[model samples]
Every structure is written in C-alpha cells, then in structure tokens.
Target: MSVTQADIDSAATTLSTVIRRTPMIASRVLSERIGCEVWLKCENLQRTGSFKPRGAYNRISRLSDEERARGVVAASAGNHAQGVAWSASSLGIASRVYMPRGAALPKIAATKAYGAEVILEGSTVDEALVSARAFADETGAVLIHPFDHPHIVAGQATVGLEILEQMPDVDAIVVPLGGGGLLAGIAAAVKARRPDVTVVGVQAAQAAAWPQSLADGHPVAAASMNTMADGIAVARPGDVPFAHISELVDSVVTVSEESLSTALLLMLERAKLIVEPAGAAAVAAVTAGAVDLSGNVCVVVSGGNIDPLLLSHVTTHGLTAAGRFLTVTATVSDRPGGLIALLELLRDLGASVVDVVHSRVADDLYLDEVQVTVSVETRGPEHQRELRRSLSDAGFLRD
Candidate 1:
C-alpha cells in the first residue's frame, strides 16, 4: 500500500512526543565543496542514534491491544534493532530481536539494554530475518519489518515534514537508501508539499540493488553484498517502498567504498560529527560528485551507531583513499644503519613515519639485503608520488 502526505502528517503527530526533532545544521565545508548551500539533517543525533525510532514508535503505537499483548519481533544488523527494542520498551511491550552473528557488539549490547531478548543468528541481516520470521510465525508475535510497511514508511516520512519546516527553500533532498523506506517516505512527503524540490537516493556501490531494480521495474536481488556500510547492505528493496520510490524519487546514485569512508572521515573531522558508513552514503555522493546537486540541498546523516574498531579502520582507509597516507616496501642494505638511513631519507622528504617493519629473511631477498616496509603520512597525491620517486632514486625500491 502507498503512503500519503496525510499519513505522514498523522505520523508526525504520533511521533510529536515520542521522537526527537533532529536538527538541520548548515554545512559550510560541504557547501563550498559541492558549490551549493548544503544542510545536514542530523538524524545521527536522534534517539537510538538514528531516525528508526520515529518509524518504530509510530508503528508500535498503532498496534491493537491484542497484537501488543503478543509482543513484537524484528531483525536488523544494528540501528533498527535498537529502535524497535527502545520503542517497544517505552510502550510497555515485550520485544525480541534477531541479529546477524557478526553484528557489532555495541549494537547488540544496546539492543539488550533496551529490554529486548536479543538472538544472534546467521551471518547477514537477510539470514537473521529468516529466523525472525519463523519465530514470529510460531510464537504469534507481531513482526516489525525494517522498511516494508505503510506505517513504517509514513513514520519515516515525518523526517521529510520536519525538513520542509526547517528548510522551506530547500531545492533538493538526498537520502541514504537501503530498503528505500527513508528515501521513499521522505520523497512522498516532500514531493506532495513541494513538488518543485528534487529528492535523490544514495547507496553503497558494493551493495546497491535499487538501480537495477528500478531498471527492471521490480525488486531484484543483488548478486553479492559486501561493504563496510553494513547498515545499508540490503540485498533487495522492499516492495512497499519501491512503489513510492519509483514514483517520487528523482534519481538514485551509488558511491564507492572509498567515498563512503572519506565522507565518514570528513564528517568526523570537519563537521565534528560521528556517522556510520551507511549514514555517510548521502554525503559521499555529494563529496564524490556522484550526484549533480545544487541550490539549498539537504543531505540526511541517517545514523551514527558505528563500532569504535570499525571507525578506526575506516578512518585509516579514508586517509589512504584521500592520498594522505602511503605504504611502501623497499630493499635496503642489511647493515646496522640501514633502517636508520631509510628513516632519515623519509624524514628529509617530509613524510611522517607512522609504522615500520624490517626483516632480512625473505625468499627473494639477498643475504645482504633487508626488506623494509614503511607506512607514512603524506600531504597529498603529489607528495606521495614525490616520495616514491625519491625512494626509487635512492635504489631502495624493488621491481
């Protein structure tokens, strides 16, 4: 069933006291970079660290007394799990959540802390969803889908309503797409009120399904799903959101893993905001030039529930992708000052050494030669190329 503007209005009223009206902050860095006035819809700072609660609370509040007595079941990698659990607990309903085995520990802990009976099952959200569906079937618990129901869509559309009120002159709205609920819902609400505004959806290139599905005029499963943006690594689009997305969303684009990491890093460093890879997808498209957006553009920073370890890894990856980090292996004479001489050379070349590993024993190394691997920080691509040339000129680089 299609969600309407009135449905979104009703959802806004339902969530008026239940959810936080997240702030919309102007992004100077992004505006200068994208050659447009950019505003960030900071749902990352919302309750449960995401916009999921807006939908989750709205959906659960509408459940019949008998359905509420039956409890609720949901499956998610992270954000949605916390949303459902927190919402259910607030409404005095029991909740059971199924999550992938490899789901972030912090998310699992947060889910349990919100009073959900957490179950670890399978290796992906889709697999966990299978378990959740079976549990719902056998236990008579009401199943709360991540993004496939009209209530959920309507609730998520409240975000769109807020954006319109916050930025009446907004020319475009960019949303991170997974199962398409947020994108579709926002598009429906914004388009219904401001038909002149453009709505775009961004997805991780490694796990994108919307582009192909839109082309085929139906939901098509992705052949493979592997990305650091686990939150949006949906294998397929939900039928409910697909219908609205096809009609309301102006365009859908994909951003690379490098772009995702880079955008996350930018948000953390420049905006002083912590956002997960999936949450950074919209900004990734803007920064990577994946979408041609102009005028007053609002990019939704969907969620900030990221593991610390994953954040560290993605930061390093982002630095490397941005040409700020360089790693190289070279052959140096196996002498006492051999490693020191290499370090001195790097220092002279204005490269800050971050890590070093030296070994003399190697299958291809000569008895008098040592393999030295070094990771250093550089200014940019030009500095990296200059460092490589200097190393090669010193006869330290091997073929």
Candidate 2:
C-alpha cells in the first residue's frame, strides 16, 4: 500500500526523538549559479551518516515481540546496513546484515561496530539480498527491505515533513533516487501538505532505472548499472516505491557521472561538505541543468559515508571533467636543456605541474625526440585551452 499524510505524521512522531532534524543551510554559491535561492538539507550529517536510519529504525521498531525476538536481516551496499545495525542495537535486538563483498571497508567496520553480525556476500546489493532472504527464511528473522516497504516509505516521509517545516516557502525539493523510497516518500508527504511545491528525483545516468521504468509504466530493470554513486546504483526500482513515485513525483531526471563528481567536488570546496556521490545527485542535477528549477529549491544531501580513497579519485576526476586538470603528451628534443625549457614555459604560462613522466623510447618516438607526459593544473576551461594553444605554438604538440 501507499504511504499517506497520516502515516507520515505517525512516522514523524515515532522518529521525533530517534532521528536528527538535520539543518537546512542556504548556499550562496549555488543560489547565484542557479538564479534562485537554494537550500541544502544536510541529511549527510544524520546519525550513521545518512537518512537510512529513519527508515530502518522506523521499520524495525514496529516489529512484534516475536519478530523482535527473531531479530532482523537486511542487505545493503553500506549505508542501509549501518542503519539497520545501529537501529537494531539501539533497541537491543540482534541484527544480521549481508553486504556486497565490494562494499567499503569503513562501512563494513561501522556496521560491525553497531553490533550486527556482518556477512560479506556477492558483488552487489541485489546478490546480497538473495542471501539475506534465505537467512530470514531459515532463522525466522524479519527481512527489512531497504526501500520497498510501507513502513520504510512512511519513515522516509519524515524528511519531507521536516523540510516543509523548515522551509515553508520552498518551491521545490530535489531528491536522489535509487530504489525510490526517499523520493516517493517525500513526494507523497509534500504533495499532501503543499501540492504546489514541486518534487523532483535525480538519478545517476549510468545506473538510472526510473526513466525507462516510468516510460514502460512499471518497474523495469536497467540495462546496466555502473557509477561511482554506489548508494543509488539499484538495478531496478522497488514495486512499492514505483507505485508511489508514478503517482506523486513531479519529474525524474538523470545526471552524468562527471556531473556527480563535479557536484561532490563543489560541495567539498565551496560548502566544506563531504557528501557521497549519491548524496550529491540532486546538486549534480541542479548544476548540470537537468531540471528547470526556480524559486526556493531544496536539494537533499542524503549521505556522507564515502571511502577516503574513492573521494580522492572522484575529486581528481571532477577536476579533469571541469577542465581544471589536464594531462598531455608532448615531443621534446632529446637534450638536457629541452625538458628544462618545457617546464619553464609551463611555469611562465601560469600552469602548475602536478607530475611529469619523461620517456626516451617508445613505439612512436623518434631517435632525436623524447616523449614527456605531463599532468598540469589549470584555472578552468579557458586556461586549459590557453595552455594547449601555447604548447602547440611552441611546436611541442604534434598536430
């Protein structure tokens, strides 16, 4: 069944002292860029570093005495696992979580720290779910579906209620979509309270399933799922969430991987926020102009639990995508002064050299020429173009 305003209200009351009422912070940079007032709902700062706890706790707390005795089993990439583990531990209920083998190390550690018996299963959440379902069947534990239950949807709706309370004049709310629980719940709650407020859902283009699913009038599996936003990389939308989304959500859009990285980088640099790629989906959509948003826009930052190494890689990728980082191979004369001259020219042109690899022998290199691969930092696209032009003019760039 679909979640209602009353259900959302009841969930809010249940979560009144349970979940954090994350702050809604205004973004000057984003507001200026978007030509509208933009506020960021910082659910990234929520307990367990995500909004999953709201749904996980709400769903588990409502279990019967017998169900609680049997405990709970769930499958997730990371955030949801931690949510379930922490929620179960808080209620003094035993929990077992099946996580993908590729799930982040920090997330695995955090889940165990929350007192859940963690089992590293398959390579994806879908595969892990198979094992979790089996465990539930064998052990009589309740299987907590991440985003496909009425109680989970009702619980996530509290975020929408909080948003409305925080920004009564908000014109739109942009949410990250995966299995669609968050988006569907928010849409249902917001539409019931303020029908005029737009509720848009953003998905990673590579892992997006909603566009095709919505078109076909059912939850259809994505052809492929490959994106750094692992948290939202569900192969298909859950039937329960799809039902609510089809009827309630105003729009569904997709943002590119480059946009996700760029948005995360922007949040880190401009807002001093460490948002995971999935959490930055809404911001990515806004920055990429995927949706026509105006008036007061609220972008929900869903989670902040990102691996440090992945963060580094994504930051570099973002810089490269934004034309702030450049890598080029140039032919230089095989002389002692040639490499020095190239470095001097780069310095004079206001480019910061990050790394350089000098090679004297290659399949395409000539006897008198040395191949030098240089990675440089530029101001932006214009600066990158200028650097390339200067290199071409100096006869360093071949064709």
Candidate 3:
C-alpha cells in the first residue's frame, strides 16, 4: 500500500496526544564549521528516547477489540523495543518484547520497566524476530513489527511532518536507516511536501543494508551485528520502506564505527546532547564526508538511549579524534626511584598517568636496567610531546 500524505496527517493526529513534538535545535558552531545552517532534529529527546513511539502508538491504537484483548508483541535490537513497550503500557495493553540476548543492558532494563514482558531470545535481531513471530502466532497476539506495515510507515512519516512544521525551509535532511521505516516515512512526507528538498540516508558501514538493497532492487542480508549503531543494525530492509526508498531517498551513505564514535562524542561535548551511536549516524556521515551539506542541513539525532559504559568509550575516542586526549606507552627503569622519577616528570609536564606496569626482568635490559611500561594520558598531542621531552632529558634510557 502506498503511504499517502493523508496517512501522515492521520498519524500526526493519532499520536499527537502521546508522542512529543521533539525540538528542532540550531547550532551556530556546527553552522560555522560546516559552512551551512546546521539544525539538529532532536528525536533523541522524543518519547521512549526515539521516534518509534509515534508509529507504535498509532498502530496499536488502531487495533481491533479482539487484537487489543490478545495484546501485542514485537522484536527489536533496542530503541523500538522501548517504544513498543512504552506505547503498549500507556494504553493499558499487555506487550511481550523479544530482544536479542546481546541487546544493551540499559535497553532491556528500560523495556522491562515499561511493564512489558521481556524475552531474550537470540544473539542477533533476526533470530529474536523469528521467535517473536512464532510466539505471536502461538499466543494469538497482534504482532507489531519494528519497521514493516502500512500503519507503522505512516506513523514514522509523522517525523517528517514535525520537521516541516518546525523548519519549513529545511534544505537537506540526513536520516539514519536500519529497518528503513524511519527513512521511508521521512522520505514519503518530505518528497510529497517539498520534492525539491534533499533527503539522504545514513548507514553504518558494518551494517549497510540499504545501499545493497537499492542496488539489488530488493531487500537483502545486511552486515552482521558488529556495528555500534545497534539501533539500525537491521539485516534486511522492510518491504514497506523499500517502496519509498526507491523513489524518494536521494542518496545512501555509509559511515565507519570510528566516525560514529566521533559523532557521538562531539554531540555530547559540543551540542550538550547525548545521542546513541545509531542515532548519531547522520552526523557521523556529515563528519566523515559521506554527505555533502554545502547548503542548510538538518541532521536527525534519532535516539539518546546510549549505554553509559559505551558513552564513556565514545567520549574518550572522540577526545582522541579531536587531539584532546593522547595515550602513549613508554619504558622506564623498573626500580622504585626510577619509576617515581618518570612519574614526577609526567606530572611536571601536566600529563596524567592512567596505568602503569612494571617488569622486574626483561629480555633486553642491562644488569640493573629492568623495564617498566607506563600508559600515560596527556591533555593533547602537544602535552604528549612535552612529556616525552621531559622523560628523555631526565637521563631515562630509550628502549
């Protein structure tokens, strides 16, 4: 079924009472850096920390009495699980969410907190999806797919409606594609409203399904679950979304894990916003030079449900990318005073030592020249060089 603007209109009205009208934020720093008016569509701040709640609520509210009585079921990597769980809970409807065993702990906890029955089924989303479908059939519950179905696609299109309402002249929009619902919905609404506006899709290099799907003229097996953008790590494009992707989406770009980490960190530090790796894929594409934003650009930050531990890693990685964090390994004498001397030099150079390892006997040490390995954290590359100079001048033997 074709997604019409009428469906988008109905979805907007159906979900308006439940989902938030997420903010459209402007960034002068990004504008200056990218040489364009950079606006961030902050869906990360939407209900359930994603835009899925819009379509999920829309789809569930339309269920018949029998379907509602039987309850709802869904399988997700993370964000959509939370969305479905939250939406079902708000309607006083029972929901069983099948999540991959490897789904993020925080997402699992959040889904459970929404009062949905959490089922950890497999290591990958596809495996869990098979089980979810079977469970739905066995229990006679209504299966609410993450990205497929006419109502779901129309519901996702509400995001585009909100964006257009927020910024009528938005020049270009960069969307993150996983199951293709979000991309398809946004593309349908945007191209229908303003066909001249550019719409681009961003994918993680490790799980770039859309590029191949577009090439093969059909949905195909995406990459394995190796990307940090677990939100969009869908192995195949949904049929509903493929329809819009073929016609409306202007381009599909892929970004690396390193790019995602850098984008996540930058959003945290500069934008004061916390976006998950998947949510930050569009920004990653911009930073990685995958998408050209020569004119005005609106980067969709799709979700903010990032794991704290992963956030820490992304932050450190971002600092490294910005030359603000430096890690260096150096050899010092294993002797107590020798290690202390190196530590003092590092302190003098304004460098902090993160870890230290000492070797009492080494393969290439003199009679009294035991070796110690030090992993010091410096403020930046310049501080790292200064620390190296301080150590070399302190009579430390080079290894």
TM-score each candidate.
0.99, 0.99, 0.92
lDDT of each: 0.95, 0.95, 0.86
lDDT of model number 1: 0.95
Clash-forming residue pairs, model 2: none
Cα RMSD (Å) per model? Answer: 0.8, 0.8, 2.4
Stretches of candidate 1 exceeding 4 Å from the true structure: none
lDDT of 1 by residue, 1-399 (tens): 988777888999999987889999999999999899999999999999999998899899999999999999999999999999999999999999999999999999999999999999999999999999999999999999999999999999999999999999999999999998899899999999899999999999999999999999999999999999998999999999999999989999999999999999999999999999999999999999999988999999999999999999999999999999999999998988988889999999999999999887889998899999999999999999999999999999976
Candidate 2 segments whose C-alpha is farther than 4 A from its true place: none
Q: What is the lDDT of residue 284 in candidate 3?
A: 88
Candidate 1 clashing pairs, residues 3+ apart or interchain: none
**lDDT minimum window of 10 residues, candidate 3:** 327-336
- The C-alpha local distance difference test score for the whole of candidate 3 amounts to 0.86
Instruction: Order the numbered candidates by lDDT, best leading.
Output: 1, 2, 3
Residues 337-367 of candidate 2: C-alpha lDDT, one tens digit per residue = 9999889999999999999999987888888
Deviation in Å, model 3, residue 158 alpha carbon: 0.9
Compose the digit string of candidate 3's lDDT tens values, residues 341-372.
77787787777777777675666677666566
